[model samples]
Target: MSPPPEHRRAPPPTDAETLCRTGRKVIATEAGAVAALASRIDAGFVAACQTMLACRGRVVVTGMGKSGHIAGKIAATLASTGTPAFFVHPGEASHGDLGMITREDVVLALSHSGESVEILTILPLLKRLGVPLIAMTGQPASTLARQADAHLHTGVAEEACPLGLAPTSSTTAALAMGDALAVALLEARGFTEEDFAFSHPGGSLGRRLLVRVRDIMHTGAEIPWVPEHALVLDAVLEMTAKNLGMTAIVDAGQRVLGIFTDGDLRRLLEKAGDIHAVPVAAAMTRTCTRVTADRLAAETVRIMEGKRINALLVVDAAGRLIGALNMHDLLRAGVL
Candidate 1:
């Protein structure tokens, strides 16, 4: 009387498997959508970059709902990458914020459907103000794209949502396209690391790219040094007084002959044989790690970590000792 096994209901998947499968599907779907965009980039993308590069005023970015969030991030990336830009809310634009935009600027609008009522409301005014409008939309034939000076297609064939309603794959495509646009403009403008640091002065990149070794190094009398002929006890006294944990043993020309550190003292103490009577030149390390004053202070981190040492002697082009810095100096300067 029972039905065949094939006709019966199959066992449900385990909860863990269900969750993993769903997560993987979303990621694979979105990844494929982004990958597909590489072939779609064409003349419109170029026109957008050209318009952005030549803009006399800021790039005004706007969108509605989920697209607005993407638009704000796009504006930020463009601004930080040497493109002048900021975001304006489309609803706010319909109010009085439209005054923030001017004829000299370029407006980049985002709308997956190309028919966001809030965005469409201001199209005529933007046109009247003579602002160049660049549209990033999923639908190429829609109003926003049709009216735009240049249209970038950010379409995705499928949404990662099970219901096919969420703005998942679409938003990812839009964000990737915005990044492409920013990078294109960055290349066209010849934006440099120093230029990026200006926008991010409070970030680590600014400290690394903008700070020079001379700015934080102990220069002049602060440089700890002893004559090459000085005894171990004399060099140890110099190191203790200067508190740099080391001293440069220099010649009459102030050229560094060698360096003696607390580590070397420790090694000598282990031997327990006339350690203090040894000449610093004999006990010191002849090959000292040195940097130039023009070098980036941030570079000290790599050198110290790679060489397993904490101090550096800075020399001039003429090979004369000019300055010195330690890990402590880098820490104080916020370069570590």
Candidate 2:
């Protein structure tokens, strides 16, 4: 199956020291390229941001080859950080996908050479639509850069590739510029943690911010509790039945008066031995922390961890017990 010896030749034996030096050289070169992009974020960068911010429609990001990968990531970051954006391949744009572009949309085109044939092919169409164009390219004098409303120069002294052919430093610079643009737009719109969580609803930050205590707390019969005058034995039975490792001591009207925990039970057994006759209220912690049903579960975790407690009782505005939750509940709900 092998056609040519030149194409089938194997690589030389590895040199660990040379490989390490090469890795460091690549990282240093890429870092320098990214750092250089910061200085170029002047008027053109501001103009690009202004254009995107003024657009009523989404940002349409287009690129070819290696630039396309960076464009997709930039699009995702933009979309998640409050700027609506999506990626469109330059090649596909020439094949009827150009219809996706509209005057309402802001076009962000990425091409190191600034003369991608596919992108240049649709440049006229974009102009015809009167859409604002923001070109990210290495060549300031290239056609794409000259025709755009704003040009972000991503030029580097040299690529990290020793052969000076592959897109190592150029892609790094482009990615850094993309991140800077996304963050600038995010701040301009005053995007908050809650807003970010809304876009990442499946992530841990979403769970912590959006999940309320009431959503995960045990309710009705599932909540472990014993009457204020109930025997310690009864409280132990309730804790075992609920498996919450603790039980609330409440009055007949369901107002939480105190809490009896596994730790309290252990301490009581060591001190008074026979809890078979002891009142639950006498053995309960009178200063136990309780929260309202509507509080955030994340807030409850902080309270529990700070106070060195495991369980908490949930009450209404009138101080009547309505629900209960422990560390285990929060953990299960991904709020831990």
Candidate 3:
């Protein structure tokens, strides 16, 4: 006998082609919506950016329903890209949350229809507080847009949803417009990758941009080094003790004169049986690459890769050895 209806296996879908076609159509529709925004970046877009850029407090983004979700994301993007911004729920604003908006703040409200009752209810309060308002909506003639200091039209030709109920292409347009505003403000403020890294210090991007060579390099006694006049055996012993596979040959003042690696020792061993008596300076690579302690660790990785070397010595402005690092150090520091 067959199992109960709820436990029974369902038949495989016979409209796989229809599913794929619908999915592709949705993507194409959304792409077109986003593309149309390129033309909408006119005087109004400039006005919105100018208002946000000049905001002394923050860009307060607010919306209801699906628009709220998009507004939240826009606020996050703005905050991360060097703009001071945060999201406020329109519905909650009527219930004492309106206190969050100060006179110095600029309110960015989103509603595709421009008639969200929750947002409209707070308009009088915003006006009383004399806070500047930027509105993003499909209806340019609606109350929100008419009262806004700057209006960004994110109108879409149609929804990708076949039933015409769900927000699909319109939300995509609004998101793209939000990103454009954020990137514009970022450029206007001269925000750099290093600045962005500070906002995201817990991520890999932060590690790559904020981790300096001085922060990761082994210093003092941990640095494998030998006197320039030392024998090859002494350099080898230092390399072994430090386990960095190389040793720096420095002068009396701790200035790097040359570098000796395991490869050089191997070559020397092949040519001469008595390496113990050979001077380290004679076997070292006279011209070697060195980096300053202030450099980004990511730059050191590129230097090592380009020159086909595994280790580097860090020096001060006067060319005195200060620290040392190898590929293993980079890996341990999460820079590799």
Candidate 4:
């Protein structure tokens, strides 16, 4: 007899469906983990936070395999959010990277099972170094947990993985718990946006948070200015020479009284008068918006946008002209 006719089966799903299903399951599992954590917060959680805040040195986070990756991210988040933290692979720490740690530091170890061999291998050395240990593990009674100075229960109900072998739900729980710790400490220390800016000095947030108007505003010779009594023609010359599109009209005390912009010049030109003979003050916007040089550039952007203007004169508390900034300055400063 001929071989049985081959039975054809339907092809597997497209990549998009698979990813969608996986993402939904992961999100559901993580939500459940966060829900579980709410009830579990107790004395131990407080102790863990206290241990981290009390440490004089950096927080050295460590883990093995997949947990190590999560540990690295946790360390980065902590470091960027005002906490000084760095990751050390458990395997590497056992070999020699343990020297990077000190008694003044705190060790945050991550393991889903709470029995990672590489992590356990260094427990004794960490103990010898007298470093406070904060354990993030699914099993509260596991060896790592028992040896820790503070054990944070990252126990998840189950993994999002169908086979329940991958470190899915557990890692999510651990990462959330790490964020909780970092944020708690961040709040406890009264850390501000300026502090965050220091850590992220090269990023967009740094520019927005740390850059003040004085840092980029045109001051001294760069400022386009003319006396209040100066004619419109002189104001135009000053504006053109400084290339700021506007000129500040100030009194003899250098206190800003008004501003004359290209728009104002246009309006003045439409009037039936001698532009050359008219004082610049007559064409200037007297109730002009102004900002202090010490104000944040980001705030200045908001003020400018809200006022529907392109330039502003930076002045002191007594209204003395100190500097000037335009939309182009904000654009160059990455605050626009």
Residue 241, candidate 1: C-alpha displacement in angstroms: 2.6
Best by TM-score: 2
* lDDT ranking, high to low: 3, 2, 1, 4
Candidate 2 lDDT over residue span 1-336, tens digit each: 866987886876579988898899999999999989878989999999999999999999999999999999999999999999999999988888888887899999999999999999998889989999999999999999999999999999999998999999999999999999999999999999889989988999999988999999999999999989899999999999999989999898988899999999999999998889999988999988999988989999999999998888999998899999999899999988
Candidate 1 at residue 308, lDDT?
98
Provide the global lDDT of candidate 3 against the true structure: 0.94
Model 1, position 17, has a per-residue lDDT of 84
Model 1, residue 66: distance off in Å is 0.7
User: lDDT of model 3 at residue 159?
Assistant: 95
Worst window of 10 by summed lDDT in candidate 1: 268-277
**Displacement of the residue 318 alpha carbon in candidate 4, Å:** 3.3
The sequence of per-residue lDDT tens digits that candidate 3 reaches over residues 141-257 is 999999999999999999999888899999999999999999999999999999999999988889999999999999989999999889999999999999998999999999999
Residue 226, candidate 3: Cα error in Å is: 0.6
Off by over 4 Å in 3: 1-18
- Give me candidate 4's TM-score against the actual structure: 0.91
- For model 1, the superposed segments whose C-alpha errors exceed 4 Å read 1-14, 270-272
The candidate with the higher TM-score, 1 or 3, is: 3
Q: lDDT of all predictions, in order shown?
A: 0.93, 0.94, 0.94, 0.91
Compare the candidates by lDDT and give the number of the best one. Answer: 3
